[model samples]
Target: MRLGSLAYEQIKERLLEGGYGPGQRLSAVELGAELGVSKQPVMEALRLLSADGLVTIIPQVGCEVARYELQEVQDFFALFASMEGTIAGLAATRCTKAGLRGLDAVSARIGHLASETDPVARSHHYRLLNREYHARIHALAGTAVVGEISHRMWDLSDFLINTSGADHPLHAALDARHDDHETIRKALWDRDAGTARREMELHILGTLSVMRPQQL
Candidate 1:
């Protein structure tokens, strides 16, 4: 990748990791000097981040991180739940034997790691397994448009996941989510498409319950 693209990825990672808070100004010259790069690459990176809604660019004031309100987070999750349900429903009918096997493997790994003593590492492992399982389902759905939307949602989800503190109820809710995934998998394995679809929708709604007033 070019220097600009490289800078873009690095800056994006920092933003996602909460290195900068909402509305914090990003000084291109300062950042460039700090990172040992030229201002041009930093400026290009800021523009890309702005395009992704991670930053806001003002002509005179330069760029600042975008602030997300509680309502905004809820709205994003609502949309994500709906889309994920649809994808899961479709995937139930479309997944091949190999696809189902892959999902099963991921779920098994998650189950194996559930007893780990380190909460942080356990959470990270669960997130990785969850991503792999969902990606497999999306691929099986065979809908390009759905896949594209899921990708965008996944990006936004990174922001939510990062901000959802370790104490969030969502952590406990994830156990229920694992069970739901297993239920959906069983339905798919049995070739019961309707059951699979209903299970997925319920699962998503169940997960949404954890994102309440405080955690938003």
Candidate 2:
């Protein structure tokens, strides 16, 4: 990959994975040194991330991770829930045997997280596995346009959840989240469109409960 794209992916990955906190200052020179690149490509990456609402760049003040207000976060999740619910509905009818099996595989890994005692590891691992579990459902939907849009939304979802000033956000809700997954899995397995859609929306909006209200 080009240096600029590489920088973008690296930076964006950190942002989604909670390496950077909301509104934390980022130094291009420091990041360049870390990535073995230069300031130019680092700045290029920041600009791209800014366009995706993950970073904010100021002319004189430099760049920091993006932060959203409580209402904005809630609104984003609401929209995200609607789209994902639709996808789950489509996935209900479009799911192939192989796709459902793949989803179950991911969910099995998530189930294992309950035994993971380390807070950071459990939270991080759950975040990633939770994403794959949903991505499997997305693939089953066989959507091209909305699936593309949902991918970006998923990034933002991770960003908000991780940066909401809650330490171990996913850890706090691990058991509940796993239970939600089981409910979703059963609906998908049964090919119940209504149940899948309803369960998905509730599961996503459930994110708000664990988020810190003060920092949101």
Q: What TM-score goes with each of the models?
A: 0.81, 0.96
Clash pairs, candidate 2, are none
User: What tens-digit string does per-residue lDDT give for candidate 1 at 1-216?
Assistant: 898898888887676554676778899999898778999999999998887778889998788877778778777777777788788778877889998898898888877765776655665566667778788788878898879878766755654555444343334556777888889889888878788777776765554465444654
Report the lDDT of model 2 for residue 54: 99
The reply for model 1, stretches above 4 Å from the true place, is 17-20, 29-36, 165-173, 205-216
lDDT of 2 by residue, 1-216 (tens): 999999999999999878998889999999999999999999999999999899999899999999888788889999999999999999999999899999999999999888999999999899889889988999999998898899999999989888887887999899999999999999999999999999999999998987886754
lDDT of 2 at 58: 86
Clashes of each: 0, 0
lDDT measured at residue 138 in model 1 versus the true structure, 0 to 100: 88
Worst 10 residues of 2 by lDDT: 207-216
In terms of lDDT, model 2 sits at: 0.92
- Let me know the TM-score candidate 2 reaches against the reference structure: 0.96
